[model samples]
Target: MSMHRTVTMLAGLLAALLVGAPAVAADNGLTVLAAPPASSGRMRLQVEVTDPALQKELRSSGASPDRFRVAVDQAGAQVKAVDRMADSSRERSYTVLAFDQSKSFATSWPQAFDLAEAYADELGARSGNHTVAVMTFGKSKSTHCEETTAAGLRACLARVEGRGTDQPVTRLKFYIQEAVREAARKQPLPRGGSREVIVFTDAGEESPALKVKDLARDARERGVRIHVVVFSAKSAGKGIAQRLDEMSQLAEGSGGRYIQVGDVDARQAVTGLVGALENLYWLDVAFCGVKPGQTSDRLSVEALVGQTPTAWSAPIDFRQRAEGTATAACPGTVVMGPSQAQSGTSAQPGTSGSANPPGATPGTGSPTQPGTVTGSPGTGTQPGGALGTPGGTQQPGGGPGAPGVSGGPAGTPGADAAPSGLPWWLIALLIALGLLLLIALLVLLARRRPEQAAAPAEKPVPPVAAQPAAPPPAAEPPPAQPEPPPAAPAAWKDPFATLPETRLVVSKGPPGLEPFYRVHKSTFTIGARQGEMDLAVNLPQLSGHHATVQLFKGGNVFVKDEHSTNGTFVDGRRLNPGERVQVRPGQIIRLSQHLELTLVQPGLQPAEPSSQVPIAAAPPSVPATTPPSAEAPRPKARTLYAPARGDDE
Candidate 1:
């Protein structure tokens, strides 16, 4: 179905629910629903919490920031208050609950729901009448671009929708200036009441109209608790996916959490948003390296806060490490510069310096303003009036001519290490060799073996004299070799765009079979193609680690070892997985004792007729049953099926 149609259907269902669903609570302002400001009224109440579970429950209950139930206590606390439903057209007041919105994750919908529940829980304890606002995307501006159509709208939404689809596939760009202008005109004045703007965008601005950084700054200045929902792009090939990745980075540059939507649950998304909308205790994390490990590009981190896995951050690249350093070994923390780290110091385990004011512990650190930097004498000035010039030079500490060396006297070096000049005989030898070119060529030609003789001498002669040779057969030219196939195409792209040309062949198995052939999980199987059975196991997605593959011909085993953050092993031996290693015919591939398989002949690279060399003669008499590896040495090239040649051509 078209994305637009799906959205419209959802909108209709929501509207229908609003109209038909009966009010469960009695009328006493018990059910508070906050509408998007029409002109900004008395400050609305926005609830921010750090609980993830509470946020999840409310979002699943179909509670919007503008709509949900709360109870008020009577004099003796026995009388329960009821809710007076507001007209759809009337001005509405509501409450907002943000759950763990401070987390730096691309996906946090689960947290948003938790926040909603927390707000409800808090409401249960209140003495007087209270209201709750569950933040949600209300209505989009009617400014229609060329994006009214499904494809166009999908593209447009790809730009604005928070964590809905893959960034690389979403070729979306909003006219920034136009969007900002529209946003400004449409936004109501702040109603002294508390309000939160939970933003769901890739934190990018492709539109020439809006400056995303400026917008974020404005939101922060205006007290808009901008909770971001990140959408990451999946890159497989060229063009769109690659550009989306760039766009995602641009969006994240503003310090907003980004969530990539690849095989991710929608409920998780909403919960994450709620978590951000409400202040949650989701732990912050940072990595030591830009990429997670030396070889793995993905950094899968699960926080064990309170003894539970809180959330996992999207994979960050090593390239980003150049701009900033990881604060610690934790994931989800911002990649901050050394200066930023200093200013934002907390009691985290690792940081450069620790600070202690009055009554503070010696080693315990607190946030401190960055210290001013002073340069040594004779330091060169940069274009921005900073010390240290681009080139290798030091300014004089004293006036222009004064020697400005600052770091103490230069240490004296040891005596000269060795002579610099080359011996005269080496040059003379080169000159002599240059003069003997003709003699050297003649010598080389004479020394050439018979097998290296000229092509003309190797041509076969026809036996015409023996029997008035038969008519020479017509010569046929050789056929050209085929090129390799292209890489696989993306599995999805608005599936309805075109018909499926290739067949999706799935293997059917016995009834009540377990889930086999998982995409990333490991599996074992026996080889059936060749005469001998070879055991093989496939492990696609390992524990955030990479493996190398190797084949040992002498040993009866083929091993895949773990050379990654998480190691892989075949039985007890670690074989590098993820790399291609050849297993010659007659070898047994072993994943340690865990799995085993014989290397079938048919699977090995076909031996070229011209490439294979004949086996060398055995020394005297040897056993006929001797193994292949123990056999006498053989020539590098062996003839396959070469046809006898004619002389005429």
Candidate 2:
């Protein structure tokens, strides 16, 4: 077949594979909004017929037609309308014909964005209660979106900076973080007010210098939502979609959302962004005792409906199960540890539990002597301490070493102290039994039955004595099966090989002249040469609604400071109260020493471009809230296929 034909066939196969799912056209036309960024104003739509045969067939017959609808909702009122028609026979596909053109019943796919744009217009018109920050670097020259609603919003674009042409993700993240925070804090947005931080940026970030964790925390605390709309693609011929994917990761990681306007018409991009924000599920969880050196593994929670597990959330570790009572596995459980492979077990709903780590040593739950573990009470220095070995010291069986075991120091003596190592009791009992058996054997020999002697002596003497017994050919025991060459030590393999890379996008620390800049994934390890080391970390905020910064010198958290506003306080004192605040890791530091920020990282998995999981902040009964339909029509949405509910619990 001709090359073009071959290509067409492959495309057809791929499209068929993707499009076979059940059709779910809403009986009620979907409302859509098209709010493209300010600079990429106007919009266009295109529809292409890739297959020559399909095009020829259409030419011989007639043009293929398509339809689109839009809707708008404010408060309890909702309005719906049909915006346009799409014709696919005239050109290769549909191509952008005009900007801001309105149609009735048909025209092209571009109209989808236009209707969505109209929806955005209506929402934007309502006196915006929250400030939307627009930050730009290397080009913007300090302009805020709130200042000029139409132009500022449209100007949401990522500025190219530095010498290298490649879009460094670090710079993009820095710009977005600065813009969002400045915008949210610029105006005294009242509590519970709607706010957004929209960034028009390239998807690249350089070696990170900013603190992302503190910034993310602050945004969540201030009730300021974040959104990123990218205008450029990676310089390496990468698709603009890839850039959008990265932006979405950062935004969603920080409890916000993002979109790419390059591929989709500007209208669609804007509409989708606004609509997604409206329907997002933002939840918070408060946790304590998650200090440094403490186990953050095997912890998970779920919100269930009777027996069937519904929404579940777990820590990064794989050993934890939800505190739910459901017999069925939950779909929302998240593991906090390094592994995603986990075994599921039934547990009470709404409660959490951890599977004890294999061979974990039981600790005394008390401070060890200074020379012992690193974090012991009296240890004066840094570097190394009395903490367990790298392989993790085994504790007592029922004490600190047991699985899911917590509370207490290592080395505390107890009946279950696993420090005894390999269970000597079994060996001792075996030896005692062996000695008893030996004595019984001797007794049996001394009491042989007399009948055996009388019956056997005559026959053996008559036959064996005469022949000198040609030595009976020695019988050989079966050749010892050569121990199967120990199966080549299972080739070392990384469980996280398929996982996407985690990028650190934001960070924060105490303002200083000689500041430390180290961005590792979503965390910033902050410290100076002399002063105590500090860190700005981005922790997943789930139903718990709280995250903390813990400082560990050796093996224990000497100081724990909370950055959560609205009561994340320290030592009985509420710092920011309900707002995001910077709490010290230890009691000694003040706001100047203690630093905090909301950090942004890559999606938990590559498939999930948006790390923000859908967690309901309100009860399920609270009406199905869709984004303003007019702003963006619901195109066929592609959601990451999560594991079957309860498969991982």
Candidate 3:
């Protein structure tokens, strides 16, 4: 009976505790997205707020400039302007797709082409609204492609199916710089909204001709957002050495995202990109948080979301040099950070910069700006610029600035402040009510105990069970669960699904190239760009658009130099650009310095041609020096040339 009473009381107490849970609103899901430090002594950091209940992202609406608690390391900073990306695409947005197009990536160009075309078509499918431009970068520069309609853009993208120019892959820094500058000035006059550049590549060589800081500066000055998507995802983040790949490094420096590619296929990758572009946020802050003589690339941001300010993100590495603000802290606001403690300021706890000039608004601290920025992405508001309501009168908080009064203790900004939690009285009352219920349950159980005890006297038969109970048989051990079978090996998929048949294989190359490119296309370009070229050669000597190989039906072949920086050679003789030279399957073609390819037609042999270049072999019957005329030189090696076919013949 006593045991039963103890259990009942414990159950009652547990119920009471469950009823006293404090009401917690959504408070902790703020993420500081990206902060690209600008060379102009300014920085922009993007953030996204989430609805805990819905598990979806939302804007921190009506958040004024003062609501943000920014820092450079531990020092305080101020936000000069606030801008929200507007949701509606009332105006067309300009996006530039800058692809490095390295040959190392395993890209399915036909499939990728379809994916990209679908994207462009979808953008313009509705009333034919054109929205994107594409540029495949190489050694020098190639003109961007933008069409009047989706079909035109499709055709332009189709042109990407062939190989690109002869530009070396080592010029990553130089190429990105050029792309940024071009994006800034190339948009048509009609595009009045946001400008973005999606840089794609697997890897690249860093060139010193243009410094990283210079690239960051140009991206900012041009108001272009740099976002990178790489094919080899392993190199997307920091490595074991804590060093990022060149692609990611460049992205971080330019304040761009190193978008992760979950799947190797381009359809899935492109789809995710399109969706992210439509849903991301772009925020700018004039963070002056660095201390004197202190320089860092890490940025810190926080905002008032609860009883006090909370960190928006951990210190992020922007790669660009970040400097401190001249002022110690935003006037009247105490420095807030992950480690810094908050305390009362001189002005007052609840007052919003009350000591500022007569024009100052309470929480805003700044009286000069009328309203803070407000809009979703695709809106007309540009980043790094102010877009508040039309009320900047200096007469002490009389204009739209009054909207800032909602800011309260702990530097909470107006409507952006965290929602009020349940009242203390209501919480206390519920707890008391739970306690009363517990007491009633306990009393009911106590009263029922006596009744239960009084009615339980009919258990005389239980005495029969007292006869010595034999120890129960020792429990048998349960059978062991079967181990799962080893997983089946993944099936292999063909890398060259588009080719009709295997006509050529890379007989020699770096390791892991055992089954190099097996191309059979009658005429295809070969270069550093995988998607743009027929046979991608990642070697340094090969240019972006190196040469085009034409497979003659008779097993004869022609190699035409595409005006590559390094001339192509047939048996050591340099072939001029655009000049097609005939050669046989046994002939070796050289590109630039180190790359050599031996042509082969497995089961086919073409007609033997007249020896354009002399062979050194001499018949035994003929006198070595006198018989063969000096003009008819003997062939030192077994070299073969394709007979002139068709017009050449």
Candidate 4:
């Protein structure tokens, strides 16, 4: 055969073989809101998918659980099952799209508009039946659609004829604040609904009247995230760079994304954002290969989507299941289906579409720490005090040490670097709703596990047809055991990873701060320094060793000033050196100028009137319902264990 004929034959043969081969596994933007796994049995994960097509399939009735597969990196453990958290699975969304008409965008105006329309048109499809409002801003602003469906957005796009203003003094902060307000008008994000404002801008400006901080605060309060799509040229200018910084601030502060896309990838970026908004899941995963008391290795998961597979992984922060001395193998129940490789680079957090974090999913008993972990392992300079490695190494078995940071296990080259650093603001959900979610969860439990909730039925003994058993000779009294050695006066046995009953619910703090921190130590130190303090605060105003919260034997709480630069305050009074004071439930602990933590006690609400009364004016009898944190009654390691509950718990 001629050379050309032979090449054609080879190409045809290659195609025929390839058709039968399995699809390659790739990252599909799987975002896991990681929590320390249940110290033992199984891991419960709040998993969200940001793949447009896959999201639809995941929520559809057609999804087959068998098609999904999950695996862990450890030697023996694997994922047993994945369940859809009905309460956490989001269903609706709203978007406010504002395209910039600034002078800086003069060169890329046409391209910018094209990208905006493309983005709006696609997102308007309402994958999960979301609404979008399209508008334009430069010297002034124009609303094309305050609220519209996919069909409506397309209809209004024809009327959009926009370009940069001659004198563009963009009040970017005010612009975002307005957008967030519009979102708020829809009311607090309804269950299964997320709010977002996407600003397509090549440039920005902040007027003195409005500020990023204020906008961020507003957006967080209104349950709105602000995402900015920057269309940059290969040779961008300094002016553009400045605006990019401003855009980043707006995005970061508001728990949204700062997406950078060239013309070639606009579609992909927009698609990712769309999928991110409405597709979230809850996974009741049973981890395998867990050694008792020892922290297990990181975990990974995989799922097949049509011919291709997608992978995900998270660091092993799950508290060990077996307590103190024993080790247990990960319960690898239904053998994992397919092992998925860990790949980075592909997961971008810009549009995680989670709660404006530092929050929780309302109406559902979701992840106890629903806030996303997005802070870097560094000083206490900001929110998202994600579990980071402190100075000391964790001694084996539950010994004290600040070891291991949070995130999925480290990946090879090209893995994502921002896995654990989600903006804290995004995680702040409604705190008041937490009570309702808990009550509902308990009621549901009462219905589902009546046996566990109710008394076990007594079984009747068979009629004594058989002769009555003779009374056995009285057993000799057991030998008196030697008196157990007294526990060290200063030592206490702290449950390594289980959450303690004494938790500090952050009533007021930075954007992405953990809401409720389980305090397992009698003398739990709270401060800004990462490795040194038991509870690390991200706010910088506070000193390194700010204060200590001591929960004593009788549930009495006291706080002591650590001689911090910015003194700690209980209720409203500042603490003096060595002046330990008693504190009770419902009192607020203010650290420095920025953060405030509230003491939460179950079945324990302080006398509200007494708490409200002036400290000096009140009758001395009922002392502060609560003190700051730590002072006298200095106990050692904590003993009361309130393990962070997984969905199962």
Candidate 5:
């Protein structure tokens, strides 16, 4: 009997060892999770190791922080930074559960609703810090429960019911979009926290109103992970398969997962979701070779735990750093010394003088001081005064210099002495008087000559017989008429008048019946309002006064955005509100997504020349034939035709 007891004890010990081995292995498994919606430039991650044993071991081992390594790969570029959060608490997570209440989901409504409630309750129980929100979409979207506690979420789910039995068209894309929008409406998760959305739907039909690709893009842009659960009773077929593929893409694009269920237990789906969420470990990494708001297509992460290296890769979207926030990892400030050479004089060998010289302006002395004075001369001294002299004397009759005056050699006058000659004004007056007397004498002599000549001419000579009057000089030939100035070239007509009139054609509208508008005015308005716009478009997307089209005098057409809610686009580039951009023929103008027009100038077809009537030679000598009627018709009056406006004058 004692031997039997020993054998039983050995069996019990063996069973205990087998059970503990799996637990130990699980404790060693490393799972890394990153916050979804990658940022553009540098990203901060919070890293966690789910295994409690490993955490305790790491703490006790006193391993260097370097033991935890994080590397990021983006668009073929790789970077590595130390993981700083290996010892920190687990990050908080915010989740939003979106339900589809469209008609297609009516059959599976009860199960889907129950699954959502159970998932919410589980998440709340797992972590009181975790936040949960519930949203439902059908013909419209409504938030049944905003972020709240576990109890509140359960109560909200209980009251939720299918909208109605009416089979309204399913807008799957719209519902997905609303879900992401609603998720983003909540307060953004704290730095290093995770935000995600779980969508429950039947995947029966998709709405044409929204594109699946667009929905995915929006979710990704908002950084909200979308987890999709397609609960349906329909058998797997082409339609169902397509729906599943699209839903999977939507989830993966936003860094989430997709699950499909039919008739089986729905709890499995919820369990899988919860497991994924709970197992996530935050990874904090530093990025290099990318600027804030700059994105890279390829991003991967790897970690080193002890000696083993484990890696996880996904398309990384780096977050834009806060505008004024300083990077925590940057090196500390360094004290810098003065850079001026003069300031360093004390440090140099054999330099004993102060930076500034004695009796000199402060901070104004040069390193190499001149022995002789370099400033301007004193006020009493001339600029050319000799060095070392207080004031120099001026030589007699020489240009003035400094204060003292010296006499010129022997009889020469000093510079300060006055001249001993007659005044200059008196001498000038005498010269003027002498000239006036000479002028009077010449005038008297001229008057005497005229009197002598008159006495001599008193005797007259005998007159000769009158000569025949000269024939009147022949009249000069008529003055030649000035040649008429060459006629000025007819003023060139307005160039735009000849340019083919441009027209806007509705390229996306009905075939063979597209709307056309001739560009008659220089400026015209375009918008949705009938009375306000010259070209009115009755579409919801277009603003009341969306934009303006202007035909410039030079024949160029331009469009200006008018601060519309949905901005205008030329070709494919969006125009800044209130911006004007030149447009060319064949370019597309999009006032909104649904309304687009093409600018066109039809080619001018050359006109065929009309055959000219041959002029008949006058009939040769044909006798005039009288008509039998009483009187011949009066000769028709010659008719004149004025040229048309555009025709040659």
Candidate 6:
């Protein structure tokens, strides 16, 4: 009995060991280093294996292409494709390090920069052909390095400072768009390569200027992955937490990862980012039954090595090229009856086959036979009149008669008639003589009127007794003049007391000083008209009334497009005509291709209300009634245009 029990226990232990060995071996230290965005029909991924032993094992096993299985599930439809890339010989990697320089990020500046440097170094070591760039954003965007080698990137990082403004606001969305645009300008990667943007920020403040959805779309279209690293000390604070959530949504939406490194060291943070890149593997996916330009089904991709599978699923859109259609040719010329001659033929009198005699003239032939009349070209009479030939002369005294004959008139066979009336000049002279006699009679009556007035002015004037003037009464002291009412205080003590102010900085024109405008009024106009617009932009691309900035009574501000020709852009999006979008303090308002302005709230806090002084009591006195004075006319309101930097007026 004891020997049987021992054999059973040994068999169970052997089974357990066998099951555990595969799980341990499956952890071959392979990680995704970079992943291309999954938008088009195919996706390319970059994967690396860190363990030297596992690399050797993979080589010795001679893992065939079939070992890597790829499948996609799109809109409930599953598709399978081949794994085309097995090595990274011709791969190129791009990395953009974006730093957030808001006030909240100042505390973590040192650690964040160190981590970025380390990340760059690791990327360079893994792939010698990799390129790197750096961008910094606070109230605006600044490009430090663009498409440079790893060493050049380091040099650019060394010059970076934590000298950002105290305001916690940052234009995160604009910076993201700018980074993607910069990345797209670089040379495209090889068939199996990848692009990545690693953003290091505390993400404490949100930008109201742009939408998160738009940023994600731009990144996907550019085929770039955006990985966000939250490295600020206060990243867990309530405000910062919300910002982090937004950042995470952006990362996930673009098929990238969001890592919270608030408590981790620089190496750990960098390692997490690198690991995500190493785990990516490329697959050449074929969408079965999908035509070019047709709306494709939602697709999902799953890559399997042995029995382990990594799956990526999303809906994709494919652009269709326009197809040309055939058009019918227009008829060359109009077709007449069968008897008609061909086009461009001259008419022949005798060739028409008429029944007229051989020696007959064209128009003088008798019309007794039907074919004789057809021989002459213009012998047929038009419907309304008896005129037969197109240009035949009329008879001397004919009235509604045939074209070639004379008609009887005044009861005779062929007599001419004369008109019976006096000439127009004799009648006109008689009317003029009557008008002259009437004028002379009126003038004679007017001259006798003055003589009649002189005869009626003989009435007499009666004499009046005059009273003696009394002595001047004692003069009374002039009444004291009321003091002019003190001038009323201005409605707003400071123009920028409550609302945010935006400074228009010229990016394209000749370099000079920029101008700043305070948004004090409820409604402000922006246009090219000098006196009509409050914030006048002189660039030719701007329309007469480009846009309007409105500050609501509730302390919120908005921007409305005024149907400008070039267009008004909030962030990078063009606003539809008459569209009104809320304006955040740090948002960018682009009036034209050449004119771009950023809204900035200068100080950290709004201005405080001014204090009021108490008035002392006054002695009471009897009131005297005074006549009311006329009210002064109100002055017309005028727009205050923002002048250029050097304009004296």
Arranged by lDDT, best first:
4, 6, 5, 3, 2, 1
- What is candidate 5's lDDT per residue for 48-135, written digit by digit as tens? 3445555455556643443443332221111234333323455455677777776666777787877887787676765455677777
lDDT for model 5 comes to 0.49
Task: Judging by lDDT against the true structure, name the best candidate.
Answer: 4
Residue 384 lDDT in candidate 4: 18
Q: What is the Cα-based lDDT of residue 223 in candidate 4?
A: 58
Better of 2 and 3 by TM-score: 3
Q: How does each model score on TM-score?
A: 0.24, 0.29, 0.40, 0.33, 0.39, 0.39
Please list the Cα RMSD from the true structure of every candidate, rounded to 1 decimal place: 26.8, 31.7, 25.8, 30.1, 33.7, 33.4
Point out the worst 10-residue segment of candidate 4 by lDDT.
382-391
- Report the CA-based lDDT of candidate 4 relative to the real structure: 0.51
TM-score (C-alpha, index-matched) for candidate 1: 0.24
Which candidate has the highest TM-score of all? 3
Better of 1 and 3 by TM-score: 3
lDDT of 3 by residue, 1-649 (tens): 6645555666656554443333132233444544544444566555544324222323434555665555544333457665554454553556676666544333523444555676675666453323577877655556567665777777778776565433455355676776776666765322334456776655554444666566665564455656666444333222211112344455655545554343234455455444444333444555433445545445555455433444244455553334434333333333323322121111112122222322333324234432222211111111111112112343222244432222221122343222223455655765676676667677767767754335545655544545787899999999999997655433323322233332434445544443433334467577665445656655544556788887645455778998764568888899866778777767777776556677665545322222542222333344333333457543443322211222121
lDDT of 6 by residue, 45-125 (tens): 334444455445446664444444222221111123323233555655567888888877777777778888787676656
Off by over 4 Å in 6: 1-65, 68-86, 147-150, 162-168, 187-192, 235-239, 272-279, 291-296, 305-649
TM-score, cand. 4 vs. native: 0.33
Candidate 3: minimum summed lDDT over ten consecutive residues — where?
A: 375-384
Cα misplacement distance, residue 411 of candidate 5 (Å): 99
| Number of the candidate with higher TM-score, 2 or 6 | 6
In order, what lDDT does every prediction score?
A: 0.28, 0.30, 0.48, 0.51, 0.49, 0.49
